[model samples]
Target: MGTYRFDPIGEAPEQIRFRVRIGPGYGSIRIGVDGIPQEWGWIAEEVADYRGEKVTRWRRSQALQDLEAELKTVAQAYNADHGSNVMTDCFMQAFFVFVESEDPGRLAWRAEFERRRRDRRA
Candidate 1:
């Protein structure tokens, strides 16, 4: 488990910080804004393919897409309240830093994890 922290807006006040806590799986991930945990959950949706077959799929609600969205919302709110011109990209860059830091040996871990999941489904 790792807890990564970064400032959404550069040189912003300490109260405007963000923290991401990641554990073994997607379910153990969490995001915090200003030390207050934000609400996040898994998302499921039905999708139809070209053949018109519909299937339900689940995704991590706070992964890249949802994480960026939530961070943008927070950044927008902060800009509106404080009259600061902070770009949403700043948060994403900081997130990428954390991702890069965790990348070492990640391929092996991911392969093993996927194999275990596949075995369970067999």
Candidate 2:
């Protein structure tokens, strides 16, 4: 497992409030935030080249990092728009959507759909 910490936005230096951890498994990677496990599965799609070469573990690790970065951006956007921090459950849901298609657009659509559903309930 690899652990990483990020300081809160516009906060004092060395003051960290967020943490992300990743654990690699057999053809899968588990992500956790602040010690809470968010999601774990084969989120990255397997790719083949003309020579029938498949994606390597390093590529999968790269994919995990890319996904994490994207999720952070989305979470920041959500916080900015809602004036509140995004919950782990929302991240988990987005991660699940990503696992389904590995497409950021699909994840965005899912988030919008969820927001609309919540608005209807409110």
Candidate 3:
């Protein structure tokens, strides 16, 4: 099961909140605020040629860094409690190599999907 962790920031009453998903293949975490799932997308690269030399058109570096930093602050307490970097992608947020974990309930759908996949492949 993927773990979910978060903390309030700025004492601002949490007008908005974000999520981090931790699961196999990075496709397990899914939750929503105000009944809407936060925008989630995977960065893809267009290989013009050459192996590992692809460029992504949707690279929004500064914005992503800002969001990542915010999420990290909120999830610090959670990370300490759980002993996991399930939210901030300790190595780096760009490249999408490391994925943060979400709350357990956040991954309910992912858990179900994994179970189904395993049962089918078994």
Considering every candidate listed, which one attains the maximal lDDT?
1
lDDT of 3 by residue, 1-122 (tens): 97865432332234445454565765333322222122332233355545666543333234334444565544453432323365765442321223243433445667899999999999
Query: What ranking of all candidate models by lDDT puts the best one first?
Result: 1, 3, 2
Off by over 4 Å in 1: 1-40, 58-113, 116-122
Number of backbone collisions per candidate, in order?
Answer: 0, 0, 5
Question: Over 4 Å off in model 2, which ranges?
Answer: 1-29, 32-103
Ranking by TM-score: 3, 1, 2
Cα lDDT of model 2 by residue, 1-122, tens digit:
87865533332223212433333433223333221111321244567867899852212233345545655665444332323347643332222211212333345578899999999999
Comparison by TM-score, 1 against 2, better one: 1
Q: How many backbone clashes does candidate 2 have?
A: 0
Residue 48 of model 3 has an lDDT of 54
Candidate 1 per-residue lDDT over residues 1-122, each given as its tens digit? 97976533443334334666653543333444432122232355689968899965544333434444546555344332323336653332222112111221343478899999999999
Top model number, TM-score: 3
Estimate every model's Cα lDDT from 0 to 1.
0.44, 0.40, 0.42
